[model samples]
Target: MKTYFRLLSFAKPIEKFAIPYVILTLLAVVFNTLQLALLAPLLTTLFASGSANATILTKPAGWADVTGYLNYFSQQISFTYGPFGALKFVCGVIVIAVILGNVFRYFAQRIMEDFRIHTLLNLRKSVFNNVMDQHVGYFSNQRKGDIIAKIASDVGAVQFSVTGTLQVVFKEPLQLTAYVFMLFSISFKLTIFALLVIPISAFVISKIVKRLKEQATMAQHMFGLMISYLDEALSGIKIIKSFNATEAIKDKFDSENVRYSDLGRKMARRQQLSGPVSESLSVAMVTTIVLYGGSLILNHQSDLTGPEFVTYIALFSRIMQPAKALTNSFSGIHTGLAAGERVLELIDQKPEITDAPDAVSITSFNHSIRLENLSFSYPGRTVLKDINLTIPKGKTIALVGPSGGGKSTLMDLIPRFTEVESGRVTIDGTDVRKLKMESLWSLIGVVNQESMLFNDTIFNNIAFGLPDATQEQVEHAARIANAHDFILQTEHGYQSNIGDRGMKLSGGQKQRICIARAVLKNPPIMMLDEATSALDTESEKLVQEALNNLMKNRTSLVIAHRLSTIQSADMIVVLEDGQINEQGTHLELLQRNGLYKRLIDMQTFND
Candidate 1:
């Protein structure tokens, strides 16, 4: 119930839809019950067969005796205008009642449909926005497919279930109550005996669907895993094909697919069973009522006339429909609640990294960025230890290291992408944590080896976040990164689509596009992580020249495995085994003949 209400809160100002729906539904129920209530009077008039001397009924005292009022008024019409006239009158009333009932029902459904859509819009938007606000590190520890499922599939299930059940909760019980009241008016004894089906259906259906919630939870989880497998396979299709592991990937995905299918079958079987059980109970109650009510009529022990008795049976049978709906909705609620739990779990997650209460937005970078006593760990392994480094403004500092040497981790700290474990990173003199993330990020630019580009036009990709960038500005940035010539050579020039992740471009072209994006941002600080290591000599030379243009008079941190790339850096910091192995100007480090020299020598020998 707690989870259910939390999901519902997304449908705020619910009264805007609820109050009107309630009024319309009430009117619909009243007229719908009238359509059936008039049955007894219509049947009574038909049996009279135009007899002017038909027995006149006493005027009913109050509305509570609804059948009495109907019978009295209908017989009065027969006496005044003959049976044919009453037939016309009763039939006309029934038609009007049906039309009004149907009209109210249609409008009521419209309101509920609007409510459902409103809730869905708010719920999905909230889920997506919250997911986007999470820190970058949060994604590293979670599966992309699992998050996708929660936002897409689970949220979809939650909206239908929560809103559908709410509809049933308000409308079904009131409908059932109206049916019961009419039955009692026709014959009190028969109504009591017939009402037993409600409890019976509830008890039997409860037992059948007792495990539905648990199965539904497992099914949602399995579906997420299957989606995860599918995502991994699609993203790594190249690797799978290269290694001849296509069949292996297919088998892994299929295994989870089969489990999800089997569980779905089980859940469907259980859900389908509830309907039949409730229907059978309804039939049994009707049969029992006929036997009991017939005995009362034949023995002359009841006030139910022949038409009234027939109407009593009609009303009793329909009562079960709402009861059946209630049971089916209960089954659906189990599944909905299961999905709701997962979605709420996501919404409830607080981002691990957030700005402090006194955080200020710093719009400029000056002096230097300093890391003091900075140590970090991931679970059981340490990634960086006591890493102290200072990067002064307008100076290019390069970090040269082997793999897993904390180069990337140290770079991430400047932007506060990852929280420090033991120490702090300060910009100028203020702690990075004291600065708003957006303000800090606005002053730094990053280009990684992967060259992350979206599937959009080159102009849009270059101006990704800067939506208002002009064409001239983009061209200038592209020229500086050596991307303008090739961009214009494409079929559409600057407007050409880059395909997925810029796959339409070559290695050098893609890197140049990424560099152009950094150049457009034109931040005071630049962080390039192995920007040229993946390129050929010709492409590397072009990218290196662009990098030099990008880093001119800017505070820069460059991480490179190619010794030739960072030799001209103002200072070179060597990191190994999560510690700074050495630090000096590139030429000074070469004079020491230490780790930096050994790396340079090894690269030269390989060349």
Candidate 2:
């Protein structure tokens, strides 16, 4: 229930629409109840004989003063005609009431539908925006399928909850109240006998609803797991084929599928029982009424006429519709609460890194980047230990190390992707933490080993970081990275669309376009992480040339897997066991004969 209230808070942005939507729903309920109660008197008047002297009707005691006003107005209209005129007027009033009820219902339904879609759209956008804003570490622990499920299926469930619950929450209670009041007016004692079953039925339905909520929560979890398994299988199709492990993956998917199917069936069965149980309880109540109310009419103890008694029975039976609706609505509320909890979980996650109070904007970079006694760790393992380093402006510092030796981790510190545990990283004399993240990050360009590209045109890919870049500027950047010639050779040149992750292009082509994108951004600081390590000799040569051009006259940090590539670096720092083992020029490190020398030897022997 608290989760639902939190979800309702999202409606605050559109309160104008929501307020009117609720008001119109209440209005529709009023008319619908009026139309149903009017049936009792219309039937009584219809059964009267042509010459029978009809008794002047007294105002119904069950309604408040507002209903009394309506009753008076209806009676005045009834008196406009002759003796049979009340019956004719009653028929016309019922027709108008139903028409008006439907009209209000139509607007209410439209408003609700709009509200659901608009709110859902905003929620989806918010989730996607949060996902985009999360750090790389956040994605490392999440499954693509689960994220997609949250946005698609889970969001749809919330929308259904909003719309479905609105109808029952407003309409059913009014209908039930109107029916109960009409029944009591006809014969108070019999209404009491029938009403005794309401609380008992409510209790039974509530008990089932508790179990239904548990099943719904389990079902949603199973749904997330199933989606994650499917995502894994599809993403690793190549690996499965290479290892001939299709059967193993299929079996795993089947296991999750079985769990999801079983949970779904259980949830559906629990929800399915609500309507039947409520209807049965209502049937029992009706039976009690017939037995008791029949005795009153038979013994002449009650003043209800034969036709009035019949109308009372009809009106009492109408309570079952609303009771059934209310019971079913509780089931929907349970499902919604479960989904709302999941959404709230995502919405409530605070980002690990954020701008601090009094953080100032950095408009320019000068002096140097200083790392003082930096230490960092993951959940259970330290990745960097008391790292001390300084990088001056306009110098290329190459980080050479074996795999898992904290080279990439060191670079990640520059952009504040990961925070240092026991040190301060100062950029141009100001601690990076004291500077706004957006301002600090805008000064750096990162070209990763895996070239990240979207399914868009070559021109758009180059201009991705610079949305306002002109066509001429895009071409100039491509030329600087040596990608312009190859791009022009393609059918559509700059307009040619790349497939997902740039799978349509060769490895070197992808890398060069990534460089082109970086060149277009023209940030002062550049971080290249094994940018040419994956390419063949020819492609590597071309990409290296482009990188050389981009790195010129920029403060650069390069993480290289192939040590030979960084032999000409202004400074090479070899990291081992999360600490710097050697630092010097290529020939100077050879003289020292330490970890850097062993790495060169290994690469030479492997080659």
Candidate 3:
């Protein structure tokens, strides 16, 4: 119930739709019930057509006597005009009642439809916004497909099943009450006998769908798992094919599919059972009511005339329609609530990293960035330990080391992408934690080994996060990164679509484009992680030149694998097993014949 209510809170200002829907639905129910209640008088008029007797009827004493009022008015029409006129009048009234009832119901449904759409729009927006705000590490621990399922599939399930039930919850019960009142006015004894089915039907149906919520929760989880499998298969299609493991991947996916389908079949069986079970119970109760009521009428122990008795049975049977709807809604809410719980769980999640109350924004970089007493670790393994370093303004510092040496992790700390475990990273003089994240990120640009380009036009990719960047500005950045000429050779130049992750471009071209994006941002500080490591020799020369252009006269931190690239760096720091093993100018490190020299010698031998 807590999760259900939290999900519903997204439908704020609900009264805008609720107030009008209630008024309209109430009006619709009244006329709808009147249409059925008029059946008694219509029958009275029909049976009396052969007789010319104008019987004067007494008006009922109270307003609750709906059947009495209908009978009195109907017979009065018979008394004034012939029985044929009364028949015409009653039929016209029934037709008008139906038309008005239907009109109001149509408008009411229209309002509810608007509410459903409004709720869906707000709910989806909230879920997506919360997801976009999470820190980088949060995504590392989560499955992308599972998050996607929560935002897409679970939210959609909530929109239809949960919000749709709001209409049934309000309209069905009001309708049911109106039907019950009319039945009682017609014959209190038979109505009481019919009403007993409520508790009996509820109890029996409860037993049938007792495990629906548990099964529904499990089904939602399995669906998320299946989506994760599909995403993995699509992302690794190349590797799967290269390894000749296509059949293995397919069989793995098929196994999950089979389990989801089987669980769906089970849930369907339970959900579908409630409808027929309630309907059958209604039928049995109706049969028993008819037998008892007919006995009363035949034995002359009751005051109900033949037409009124028939009217009672008619109204009694219609009660099951709303009852059946309520039962079905009860079953559906379990499934909706299950999906709602998943979605709400996401919305309730707070990001581990957020700006402090007194965090200030820094508009410019000055002096240097310093790491004091720095140490960091993952779940069990330390990545960086007791490391201290300083990067002054307008100097290029390169970090070269073996794999798992924490070079990339060191760069991430500058932009506050990963929080420090024990040490402080300060920009100029203030702690990075005391700086606003947006302001901190705005001062740095990054280019990774694997170029991260969206499936968009080259110009759009280059100008991302800078929506106001002009074509002239974009072209200038591209030229500096050596991407301008190749971009012009493409089908539409800068307007040409770069396929998914820039797959349509060559290795060098994609890296150059990524460099161009960084050049466009023109941050004071830059982090280049193996920018040219994946390219061929000719491509490497071009990209290395472009990297040189991007890093000129800027505060730069670079992680280079090729020893040749960083020989001219102002400072080169060597890390091994989460500790700084050497730090000096490239020539100075080689003179010392330490780790840096060994690395350069290995690459020299390989070349």
* Full-model lDDT for every candidate: 0.91, 0.83, 0.90
For model 2, the stretches where C-alpha displacement exceeds 4 angstroms are 50-87
Candidate 1 local lDDT, 532-602, one digit each (tens): 98999999999999999999989999999788988889999999988999999988999999999999889
Q: Residue-wise lDDT of candidate 2 within 587-606, one digit each (tens)?
A: 99999988899989999999
| Stretches > 4 Å off in candidate 3 | 51-55
User: Can you give the TM-score per candidate against the true fold?
Assistant: 0.98, 0.93, 0.98
Q: How many pairs of residues in model 1 come into backbone collision?
A: 0
* Superior by TM-score: candidate 2 or candidate 3: 3
Deviating ranges (above 4 Å) for candidate 1: 50-53
Candidate 2's TM-score = 0.93
Tens-digit lDDT track of model 3 for 1-607: 7877787788888899999999999999999999999999998888766556635569989788799889889888888997788899999999999999999999999999898888888998999999999988899999888899888888888988888888898899999999998988888877787777578988998888778888988888888898999999987899999999999989998999999999999999998898888988989988888899999999998989888898998888898888888888888888889999898889989998889999999999989999998999999899999999999999999998999999988888888888999999999999999999999999999999999999999999999968899999999999999999999999999999999889899999999999999999999999999988999999999999999999997999999989799889999999999899999998799899998888998998999
Better of 1 and 2 by lDDT: 1
